[model samples]
Target: MTLWRLEWLRLVRTRRLVAILGAYLFFGLTGPLTARYLDRILGGIGTEGVRVQLPAPTPADGIAQFTGNASQIGLLVVVLVAASALAFDARREMAVFLRTRVRGAAAVILPAYLVSAAAAVSALTLGTLAAWYETAVLLGGLPVARLLVGLACGALFLAFAVAVTALAAAITRGVAATAGAALAALLALAVADGLTGVPWLPTRLAGAMETLVRGEPATGLPAGAALTAALTAGALAAAVAVSDRREL
Candidate 1:
């Protein structure tokens, strides 16, 4: 069987595909609902002597909530699922089997990495479409062109995330360790971007949806998106090189 087909079969058989899609779908459906009802929801809490005033819910707020959920828990799920696929060689028997059949590390690893990335991007796109529909119903219609651009930016960031998982898997000995290392690296990048407020940081793509929804000029997004794509390619290359040298 082709490696690509094998990866897809593995993802489905293991149910990671379902988990990733389900998590994003849950957030997509709830994000708009939460944004629309947030004021009433807060009022029900009944904090004594605390008056909380919130702006009326907007389409931007709905999309923001969706991206916010995606950037947090959704991102982690993607990383874990990607790590599981990339780290399949963690078992000695599996490693030997793959090493013997594949021409090189790239042959063994690229399909798994690309399949994981494709699954993640597809899930995110599905969730984004769900959020867009609910936002149009609950709030108002958003700019389709801007939202599409933002979605592209978000997809690039997710692809980069999977690449990071691939690199971590190449270096780490187990699935958990690979996931942890990739998450740690991502967290550090997020913190750095938060502190520096750099326009070119790939982390900026995480907020692309909210920003574009608010009608912000996507002037900075191109830089961030380019950097994200570059980083993803570099990470994939590094993963292949590192895996090539490692002892099976």
Candidate 2:
């Protein structure tokens, strides 16, 4: 309880979250606005009499654009934040007091992963909500049930990112190494899923998110959800194990 509380308190007390949320919020607004006004935006900058004809933007188009930005750019932010989850540590002598006082290394890792996942999920949820509302006002509202499914797709990927980054942290030191490893692992998952056509990978969930947003059936949803749940638990266990083996 104390660890969870500490992790949550640290997350809320920092300025990093404000910046991350603001960045995602900007994307949520701009993605739809860009899709909605692409013609005008291009026409305004068109060379004299050079016409740029564009297709009529659909709900799917706007949602696709938003998800594209969130999955790639938004994903980067999640990795960076999650990578920093374990940036603090005391020197060997200085670490003794707190290190020995806790239940185990898992106590440190679980709270960090859980708290970071919560924060990332919340940011994505709010950002998606903003994008949804703006799409309705500026474009057209996606059907509510489908919209929720699409949102879950992105949130699920974020949870995986958080878990993967926590695992990276447990095994590595420093922000760059943790983030780099985490990104590498996620990319590997994507590539493997593509080659193997596995339905249970977190990358599948992310891909399914895009599919769902576009009014298509996410046939892989069930398997992806099951795998995500399993992988999250497994990744947390791995993190705890690695952290335990480390010299505090």
Candidate 3:
């Protein structure tokens, strides 16, 4: 069987695929519901004397809720899943077996990275559609063009994230360390993006959905998206190089 098939089978046997999809889908289905009923939900909380009021939910609010949740905890699930798949050295025997059979580092690594990336994007797409449908039903209709654009931007970020996880897996000793390192790297990037206010930072893609829904001009998104693609390619190559040098 091909390495791609093996990587897919690894995800399936480990149930990481289900975890990834289920977490995103949960956020997608619930985010709109939460937005639509937030006022009512909050009405019962806190105290009997206090009250809170919120504006009527909009399509942007629904999508924002979904993206916000999906980008945080949902992204965590993707990172953990990808790191688990790419940290082949966690299983020393299997790593040795695969490395000996493969022609090169790329042959051993590319399939796993691509498979993880494909799975991550698929889960994100599923969640995006779920959010769109629920928001349309409960809040309001959204423009398909804008949603598609946002989804494309989001997918590019997911690719970059998986690439980062791949490189982390090459450097770390085990799945847990790989996940922690990748998450730290991602968090650092997010913090840097927020502090610098750089229009071209890839972390801006995290808000692309909300921005598109809010009718904001996406002039900076193309640059961020392009940089994300370039970084993804660079990270993947770096992962292969790092893995090539490591002892199996």
Candidate 4:
């Protein structure tokens, strides 16, 4: 517990973490608000006597916007922020020092994992609250179940992100390489989602909010969640193995 508290404080003192939270908050507040007024914003564009008619927005529309932005831009920001959390410490030999002092693999790994999880949770919770408030105001009151669904999805996605970032840090020695690797993984998933109809793809997991709000079971969501959990566990194991092999 003492070790975990120290790690948490170290992470909190970093400027990058604060920037990540700010960026996510901005996107979260804007997602639903932008969706609600999207039609009006598009309609305002008038040129050469051309007009486009859009149907009135619904609660689902707002949620869709929130999901889309959160999944796209929000995920990118998180990846960048978390990449350094894992890689930077390792690159600077901080991980090695901590491991030497702590004198156990679990002591070092557990604290790092706790810090990452705490940061991810804090950012996601704030973003969720921002989305909920914006959505409720734009499209009346939202259901509690739908909110829970979103929260769950966010947590699952963040777990996947943390795992991948840790893996990148373990595999690479430089922060730049780690960041690039993490971003590339995210891009590949996005590309696969755009090109293939695979149900369990990571990119599609973000959009699962639709099924939750509609009170319908999403066939792919559960599978995606399971796969994500497996992958996360694998990454954590690999990171631990690598840390164990390194000498301070």
Candidate 5:
């Protein structure tokens, strides 16, 4: 608890948290709203007098836009921000003194995990609320079950992001290298999903959000959840193993 508090305080004091949260909030609030007004925006573009007739946007359209924006751009931002947190600390040797004095991997691992989890929870909660409100206002009434399922999917997606970022940070001692590796890993998974047609991978979990929102049984949800759990375990084990071999 004490170590977690210390790490939490460090995270709170960093500008990265504020900046990332602010940007995410903006996107979360605007994603569905923008989707609702897509026709208007496109028509206003007035490209070469080409009149494009767009159909009226539906609830599913709004959800699709929200999921697209959140899963792609939003998740990328999350990975970068989370990777920077620990990567920066490692690069600056910020944990050296603590590592030497604490004499246990738990002191470092627990706090880092707690901080990452807290950030994920906050972002997921805010994004879910914004998505729900936007859907309600723009698309009229939405089912509570669908909303809950979407939220669950979002939470799981955030967990996958945290796990990936932590593993990247643990593997690389430099901030830039860690961030690059994490982003590359994420991008690779996305590319693989596109190429291989596997929706059950950890990286493609966010793509299942729409299914949940439609009250459909999400086929990829359980498989993605299992993948995330396995990845998280692997990341933690790798971190502990690496920490044990390090000189601190």
Candidate 6:
């Protein structure tokens, strides 16, 4: 509890918590609003009096936009922001301080991760609800239960991302390198998902948000979620082990 509280303070002092939450809220609002007005906005941009025939936007369209924003930009934000959690401390002689302590890597890593995850999940939840409200008012009402499932799946991906960033920061000294390593790993997962439709891979959850929103039982997601959880745990464990090996 002490360590977790300390990490939370760090997040607050660093202003990362505020920034992440603000960005998530902005993106969330943008998703449905854009979906609702995209045609009107685009039509005004095109040649004057040249009517553009666009398919009617629906709740699905708004949700799809939200999913895309969260998966792409939101995923990147999680990696970039969390990448510095450990990297910045590496140069501060924290390694020596931690080495003298009784707590192992999990003790240190979990708090940082949970703080970031909590902020991310909270923002995502708030944002998604805002989007849902907008879509319900502008486009149409969405299936609440299924939307929640999709949000849960998306949050898992984010949790994995925070773990990966921690692992990268543990291995690398530079922020850019840490971010690169984490993003590269995510890209590999995405590529694997696109190239091969494996049922057991966690990447399925990343892409499964839309499927869940569509009310389709993600046949692969159950196994994929289990896989993602294992991988996140593995990443945190590896980070602890690696950080322990670092010279103070």
Global lDDT of each model?
0.92, 0.77, 0.90, 0.72, 0.70, 0.79
- What does candidate 5's lDDT look like per residue over 1-248, in tens digits? 47777667766787656655665577667877887888778888879788767787766666677777777677776776677665644654566756666767656775676587667667766876777788778876567776666667677767766667777777787767777887888788888978987768876567666776666677777787888778877876776667666653
Tell me how far the alpha carbon of residue 78 in candidate 5 is from the true structure, in angstroms, after superposition.
2.0
Where does candidate 2 have its weakest 10-residue lDDT segment?
A: 86-95
Q: Give lDDT: candidate 5, residue 200.
A: 81
TM-score of each: 0.97, 0.89, 0.98, 0.87, 0.89, 0.91
Q: Which pairs of residues collide in model 6?
A: none
CA-only RMSD, every prediction: 1.1, 2.3, 0.9, 2.5, 2.2, 2.0
TM-score of 5: 0.89
Cα lDDT tens digits for candidate 6, 71-174: 78877776777876656445557655654674666666777778888887887777788778888888898888788888888788788888888889888887
Candidate 2, TM-score vs. the true structure?
0.89
Top model by TM-score, which number?
A: 3
lDDT of 2: 0.77
Angstrom error of the Cα, residue 160, model 6: value is 1.0
Give one digit per residue, the lDDT tens place, for model 2 in 69-137.
877788888888777765434235534654787878776777777778877888888878878888888
- Model 2: per-residue Cα lDDT at residue 201: 74
- Model 3 ranges off by over 4 Å: none
lDDT of 4 at 3: 74
Residue 218, candidate 5: alpha-carbon lDDT: 74
- lDDT of each residue in 1-248, candidate 3, tens digit only: 98989998998989988998898888889999999999989998858988879999998999999999988998899999998888988998989988899877899778888888998899999999999999999999998899999999999998899899999998888999999999999999999988988877888998798899899999789889989999999999999998999986
Which residue runs of candidate 1 sit more than 4 Å off their true CA positions? 48-51
